[model samples]
Target: MAVALDIVHDTQETYRKVLTSMSRPGTISTVIGDMDNPFPCHYATFLTILTLLDREVYFHVISDGENLSKVITDYTLAQETSIENADFIIVPNGTNEEAVIDAMQKCKVGTLEDPQNSSTWIIEQNMISVTGTITLTGPGIKHTTSLHLDITAELLEMRNRRVQEFPLGIDLIFTDPVSLACIPRTTKVSLDGGVI
Candidate 1:
């Protein structure tokens, strides 16, 4: 039992580091956990699944394949659920704007009393940059900050729509090969819409 507790603690620590990295944007972080797989999912994704998933958590995989589902189930011991019922939604790549927005609409809002029960969406980006002209504001920002992303305009529109829900919409974590960025529902984003 002691060993099990230690493992859980370690997992939580790893996740905390990852979350901190994401919250800061353009930052790189490493995830040291118990994942033994050598293929497909990256270390960050593996750590995320290990930390956030369990028997009580339901995850939706939008990447399209049994391999992802198998990997998630084997690593996290989480149940597979549809978009409407998922507590966490993972998109291995961040290109599916329509699907992501549709899934977001289906996620539970958890009411005003328990907003933490709401769903979180994880999307993997090809790369993350700190040079884009877009600015972000809200809880995580001291004032406003700029970030560059390889995101589509359609996705930004969807995010804007989601932002209108304020504290009730799904939060986003965008991961790249070695870094991550988070845009919580509370964030207000403004895009330059310029060519990059």
Candidate 2:
């Protein structure tokens, strides 16, 4: 069984965690609640969307199974749109590399004057495995902080290219059942080895 999030309190906490996590890039923040989602995606991902989405924003979900796009639309009353037009893009872990790259390419990156208008990506992963190392630095880091992540080279390359435009890139939030982390556009990410 699953319990609905306490809209008022849980959202407030989740919002705080998101803010704190983004401010301290690479740090994991615990998500406060869960929902009864039959999808393979994480509950925290659903919770995050519930807390953030509104009828005014457009959202898109990329899932191999489950009609998450329809579910989110019905729940939030937010329009279910194409990735290119969505304000938020949600994807499950291990989505096809080509599809992920295509989505990344098509999504809005915002303009220099209105960078905050860019899309936010919610990537659902089961665990933060230590297959490879990445060093993050920028607004949140004291000097530089390192983390182990199981992300693909192609995905990282896309992010690298996007962030090259500076304030015109999309922001990302990685979530699991219990915790979440972020990689804001302003953060600098460097891979330890050649690629992973």
Candidate 3:
């Protein structure tokens, strides 16, 4: 096991960086900062899990899982559960459209009265860049922003279907080897080179 990362300070700082990405929607940011990431997934993904998961929650991995569920439990004290009940759904590979959408279909989209009970998805990608054409607008954006994430348009369309209901939706966090970007439920995403 790698013995790096001052849990308290490192986790706090990483949490802030993650929060910044989430709060700002499409803004790209880095996290975990060379803290000896020993997991098979990205440093940002591992560190984000460290920051958000704990004993009270459960997590489930979809593809390229590679025993990460147990590994996460070893670090976060969070247990592994069925996809439908998972608080955090980790997808190390987003190339499988069928499985990705299948999991998303099963994942919780909180009710109108208890919207806070929804799931948070942590998905790994090739990279998170600023040059892509997908437009993002809403809450934290001034006018608009764009990202170049390699996630499938079909998956995004699925997200729109699931989240368009407002309060009841899932939040997305995409990470590369070290960087991450968030797409909160409230953010409007468009791919036709125009606002949705």
- Give me the candidate number with maximum lDDT: 3
Q: Global lDDT of each model? A: 0.68, 0.80, 0.86
Q: Residues 44-143, candidate 1, lDDT per residue (tens digit)?
A: 5656667778878998888665378777788778998888788988887644677766776677765667777777877777766777866776664677
- What clash pairs does model 3 have? none
Whole-model lDDT, model 1: 0.68
> Candidate 2 — number of clashing residue pairs?
0
Provide the clashing-pair count of each candidate structure.
0, 0, 0
Q: Per-residue alpha-carbon lDDT of model 2 for 129-161, expressed as tens digits?
A: 324378778998899777666677678889878
Clash count in backbone of candidate 3? 0
Q: Comparing candidate 1 with candidate 2, which one achieves the higher lDDT?
A: 2
Error of 1 at 134 (Å): 3.1
- For model 3, state the Cα shift of residue 18 in Å: 1.6
- After TM-score superposition, the amount by which residue 52's alpha carbon in candidate 3 deviates from its true location, in angstroms, is 0.3
| Model 2 residue 54 distance off true place after TM-score fit, in angstroms | 0.8
Model 3 scores worst on lDDT over the 10 consecutive residues at 30-39
Model 3 misplaced stretches (Cα beyond 4 Å): 1-3, 34-36, 194-196
> Considering only N, C-alpha and C atoms within 3 Å, which residue pairs clash in candidate 2?
none
